[model samples]
Target: MALFLNTPKLNYWIPKLIEESEEELILIVPYIQTSKNVLNALNKADSNGVEITLVYRENKLSDYEKSKLLALKNINLLHHPNVHCKCYYNGDLLIVGSMNLYEYSEKNNREMGILMNRIRFKGQETFASRMVNDRTDVFDDAILEIREIINAASLEKASKKAKQTAFKIDIIKTEEDIVRDRCDRLNISFLNKKFRTVEYLDNKWFAQCENFFDKVDVVFQTHRIEITFRLEQNELYNLYRAWMQTYDLYEFHGFKYYWNKPDQELLVYKHDNFDWSTDNADCNKDKKYYEGLSTIIKKYRKITNK
Candidate 1:
């Protein structure tokens, strides 16, 4: 059975939901302008070694909120553009509501929620509520829906310190990348267009291309690192668009651009200087590689309306 709750009760129980967690705390709430009490509860939960997963609206977090949230330990922050429901669950106890987890929503808005315990329900049977009757109304079904939402959300890395401590490991590869190499000669451009532009680098919009000009901004923080990663995809298109005015300068994404002297070349994509002798087998391999690469480049041009 689920206990109905109003605004005051919602505030009281949300913190309680977080505080009572012995292992994991999952909060799927959008627009997280957390009140002081709620923020303190989250901080304390982190101190106690509770694994917390918080999902909020994408690009909605201000730098202040980010600084505060990123400072915590044992917490995973995620972003979902579509998340609007408010749910707080600690494995067994669940709160489903018309809440935003925003400070004003709890203090001023007349919000409502239903508190449920999985322990109260026996087996796979769903307890019935007035005005609703179905398999979906069960407590287990609600849990499943929450899990689906979390699965669809993208993991957002918010820590500046983590980004500053750069990893020397570059490139995104699967067993597929390794297998393809076993069957063909490889180049930086091969993985460059094949992985970074065509598919998501890591199923996230942002991905650093494996080698080729990737290590240039090993020190520059801000958006420079992210922009340089994107330049791999941009530079590939620039090769045909004459966006380059000089070897050192280029335009990106329809904007006029220039290279910062401080942001000097960390890495630049250069084609193979291999001199090919026109033997029959060598000619065949060269043509095959060119055709394959040209196809990918053409497809990217179509997708980007270049």
Candidate 2:
């Protein structure tokens, strides 16, 4: 008898499918959204040279989402308007699932699915072969019909009116002005050679530094310290939290930390950049400042392995 059960925790089966898959993998999800984990899994399969065929609702894709999908070399995004089923097939193992391959559905939300193993039989062999042969032809015809509708709509005037509008602007500021105005306020050093070098080169590091500080509470001993920065996905926040807990240390100089929200603006520190002099002997006398700064730098360096 075939086993039937509620397939909650869909991610648990992905690794299994990935491991056992040999000849081909077919995924049919109506709504396709990209996430870091999903991309990683797909890339892993691609690295192993798995033949992946994806069918999704093309009309639902946003402009940015389409760009991301198009960037993948091996993955082909087929437009299937009538496709509402969420199914995964690896060889003879077929999985029908209620969960979409999205972050909320796969990670937090409660969802369910079912797994079925199809067997090959002598009498049904011809039927199965015919189904396999006709699969692409039938799916392609449906997809082409939808694409024609989309192309026709694109030529309409109202379609042009409904399109999203965007614009770009540039801001100019001098280094000395920025340091005097912003760094001095945050009590961060702005004079270090390293600080000046990293100020403008894709400040993702500064963003991560800010996030690290906000996610944890810290006590600082140093008045001034240099901090390095890097941008990482929000999912890695747990790893950072674990690292901080293990070390019992925090506080880094780079930027001000913000609240833990996806859309929250990054808090910029007044002392975002600083220049300190060794010749200033009186400034070095503050033991708390030196110790606190040293601790912050050391912890950051350890976390980044820099």
Candidate 3:
């Protein structure tokens, strides 16, 4: 175990802690306001599939900071009303100290902390017993008891947050249900909504019915109708590509090639097509389009399981 005293340079160690995280990262800080470099590191850690749990006080995070933090895909932000513990830890290591993870603390304040090397007894003791601190090995049995106490505090905060999230999700689902119900009334099979854009996907193809970008269309228009088929599977895709090449086919359901790229590319397709213009009008045409697409999907599905 080592100690770092009056070290504003602790910001440098933050990145190291985040990078070294193997399974999970637990951070408890009262506030956070960090640089883009630090943010990028956190984003990179999230992209690596690390389970990150950040506990902080509410109202301490600014709107801009909150937006940036929320953008991370795999981070769980927990709000505690008066949390003051500034600790960063993972399964193998524990860093507990007076650091805010803020740019101001790194650049301005004198902070201090101790980094404890966790002792593990893999395959000998149970996973719970294996997690006891090296320094606290004398009271190894007490580790679980301490965790239980901490977990109760953490769970209380988590429950409150879960309620808020559940409420918001309920509102969103209710809105989607209402919209889907109305679309069903219009004799159209409604697809899932993503990014405020409603899509229809019953025909084994993707269709963008409405985009969040166009407010006028979202408010008044029932359907915007632009269908897309992803030639993602290999066998069926190869067959379809060969057929397209043989027939010199360019258009499908009044939609054209949105892109034509090489197979080596991650999103490459033999002939990717979608309709984005005036011709992709609602209801009857869309129904006809899906009906035509159903034949192709049936043919392809016969050859490949997908």
Q: After superposing candidate 1 on the true structure, give the runs of residues whose Cα lies further than 4 Å from its correct spot.
A: 120-137, 158-306
- Judging by TM-score against the true structure, name the best candidate: 1
Residue range 227-273, candidate 3, lDDT tens digits: 23344467436754654453323434443222243232111112234
In model 3, what are the clashing residue pairs, if there are any? none
**TM-scores, each model vs. reference:** 0.46, 0.36, 0.43
Tens-digit lDDT track for model 1 on 1-306? 567999998889888878766667778888888789889999888888776778888888778887788778767788999988888887556788998768899789999999876432122332222223222235446666766776798877623322453311111123233334422433333443332322233322222334323322111111222223235555545543442333332212111223333233322221234332342363354344444334433433554455
Best by lDDT: 1
Q: Between prediction 2 and prediction 3, which has the larger TM-score? A: 3
Worst 10-residue stretch by lDDT in candidate 3?
212-221
Question: How far is each candidate from the true structure, as Cα RMSD in Å?
Answer: 21.1, 22.5, 17.5
Error of 1 at 35 (Å): 0.8
| Candidate 2 structure quality by residue, lDDT tens digits, 1-306 | 222334343676654554445545666677767666666766677667565556666587677766765555445456665667776665445556686666666667766776555332222343223322222223333334433433333221211112332110001112223333333323343122112212333221111123233333222212223232333556346435644465421233422343233233222232324333442343342233434445554665567555
Better of 1 and 3 by lDDT: 1
